[model samples]
Target: MAKRPGLGRGLDALLSSAGKKQEGEEAERDLKQVPIEQIRRGKYQPRIHIRPEALQELADSIRAQGLVQPVVLRPVDDGYELIAGERRWRAAQMAGLHEIPAVIRDIPDQAAAAMALIENIQREDLNAMEEAQAIHRLIEEFGLTHQQAAEAVGRSRTAVSNLLRLLDLEEAVKAMVDEGQLEMGHARALLALKGEQQVEAARQVVKKALSVRQTEALVKRLQAGADKPGKKPAAARNPDVLRLEEDLSERIGAPVRIDYDRRGKGRLVIEYNSLDELDGILERIR
Candidate 1:
């Protein structure tokens, strides 16, 4: 006992010092250094789309105030991959920044996809098409189920399903959406039709500058016509359908379509290009 010579006290001192060093090491590890050029866009990005005007505005903001928040990134082979704040990154580039501050993470591709989708959805940065695409990517790329993706994006599985349905529209219709001419509601209405009918209805809604109701009515008419025998309604088969759809599509910034049957059963199809449009439709329906 006498020979112990305060060994316990010495050990206690050593342990306390080790604890402090460990804490200091952890704090140092938490510090991040991110390179600007190394920050590249992720393969499974959250934002499926962006508006030029919005980007321009963001550029202006970055030019004036600088990026308020640093972007998040993960290490990759060629460069640091973006995790969030894509808009900010794009704007930073526009603002002529050479290097950007970022927090480095070790997230897996699936986790990154999930995080990005959630970030975009929470910020309302993604349009309907973009959101749909993100959800699709999460499912396809990350092997997430529709329910899992929906949970990540804080949307219902049905809502995710409907968005995916929008992708089935004609390229022209999808182009209208990407261009911000047609909304998702307009697209949904158009989806009621098959092949050429979808395109035809989309044309009418745009040209006629039809209201959502009008578009829905036209879609209903076309659906009914399809169900009934004989020729379709004049409105459904109207030559002006395309022009009308274009006009309305341009006016409302959403795709529009009119559906009519020879039996006079008619419905107008209004396609929404974005989640905002879908939200508006939901509000109206509610």
Candidate 2:
């Protein structure tokens, strides 16, 4: 029948596609009041945590006004599987509704997953960690490239990359993010550290309730103090010199070292990874 819309065409196209009847498909595209017990949660559903209070609030709303939007579902062995609107489904169950309105369609696993990710992202329902994990699954399970994943979610490649980087965080730190104690920005800042330092820094961020900017500064200061093997302790260096080194390194996009003798005679060394980087640094200096 008609070609299924590409993931790059975005959520609207996908949702619209779900509404259209495809040739040779047994299911018709229409809203049906499906029994709550017959519709099970989808394997592709990306959301992990549903706040009790929020679900209660939604349940109250559904009780007062009814479900404004129908959840999308795909046919399965004995029951239908949720394709999107899991929040609505959960809230309906909580509201003690025997049946919920849903749009039944027959779609593949990948489309169902992409639709779920797009719906949650568009609704701003997922926390940073959940969103990251969803995006990551889109890549790993579907073999979509970074750019393709970004397009599927209607986000920039850099945004997708940043979210994926959150997955690199220590599990404890990721929990903090998932729990909303730390924001995405704070998590990204924490990525600058590794090992125990990252864990401790995450604790400090939550305990102190540090803002994103403050967390970034803390990461910089921590990096300055972190002593590596074969290197002098940065704590011994003048704090002013350390700050200068960090500032220069940030501005030049390279590692910078500042060494000063007691008489104030010293050198500012900028490290580069490549000849092109060296040329860029020289250009900046000029």
Candidate 3:
């Protein structure tokens, strides 16, 4: 497949190039002055939380230095819809600006949605739940296959599948993930249970501040109890080994498992769902 233009560029370049045009076989970004009041929040924006203090800080910066980067917008029936830089738009409004600098593009709905999702992913702005919801929206609303959606966001198919799996989480548990109460690994482990069991396990995980490894163990115990009537509980792992697993998992951004014995001979394992994630883990180790 041919590589898409501006896919590898960082957020700023992507935002600028979102409105790129070809004139005599040369491409250039054109900036415009758009009325602040006429711009509307984008339908595909992935970020759900914008901190008040951070918004104020950006507003202050705009008030002093002006908006250094222009926002990306596309034409809509009522007015221009924001394609990227919702933060800058909100801050410009907070700074009492009548007009904001913007790059106007005439793109279809799928293009706009993909651009919005790409911008947030590049910026690392969306939490796991928000990102999953955004990816799910992109796939469902546009009828894009997992591979197509993965290509749109520059993610592996496995990575995209894992994110979509997060959506299967019960709404209350999903809220916890969205609110930063649970990490991705914790949520993934909780997926082993269903209904009230899953929700209750999530609460217990949060209330006790359990690590990912511990959360997995909790899920296992719960599953065992529900599945087997008289099965013996597994022996507890050494606390030190458990801590090491948690620490390694935290450092590598993937699940880690360790096996230990009386002779101090054991194995260490790190689990990754996709090649991209495996690459990330390897990089972190190096």
Against the reference, the lDDT scores of all candidates come to 0.68, 0.78, 0.78
Cα lDDT of model 1 by residue, 10-72, tens digit: 323433453455464554326364667888897767665688789989989988987778887
Candidate 3 lDDT over 216-246, as tens digits, reads 9898788667435777777766888878887
- Cα miss at 26, model 2 (Å)? 8.6
The TM-score between candidate 3 and the true structure equals: 0.69
TM-score of each: 0.65, 0.73, 0.69
Candidate 1: C-alpha lDDT:
0.68
TM-score of 2: 0.73
Model 1 TM-score (2 dp): 0.65
Off by over 4 Å in 1: 1-33, 46-48, 226-286
Instruction: Evaluate residue 37 in candidate 2 and report its C-alpha lDDT on the 0 to 100 scale.
Output: 95
Q: Write down the RMSD of candidate 2 (Cα, Å).
A: 7.5
User: Clash number for every model?
Assistant: 58, 0, 0
lDDT per residue for candidate 2 within 1-79, as digits (tens), equals 1222454345445545754635445455667899999999988888889889999999999999999999999899999
Q: Which of 2 and 3 is ahead in TM-score?
A: 2
lDDT of 2 at 224: 74
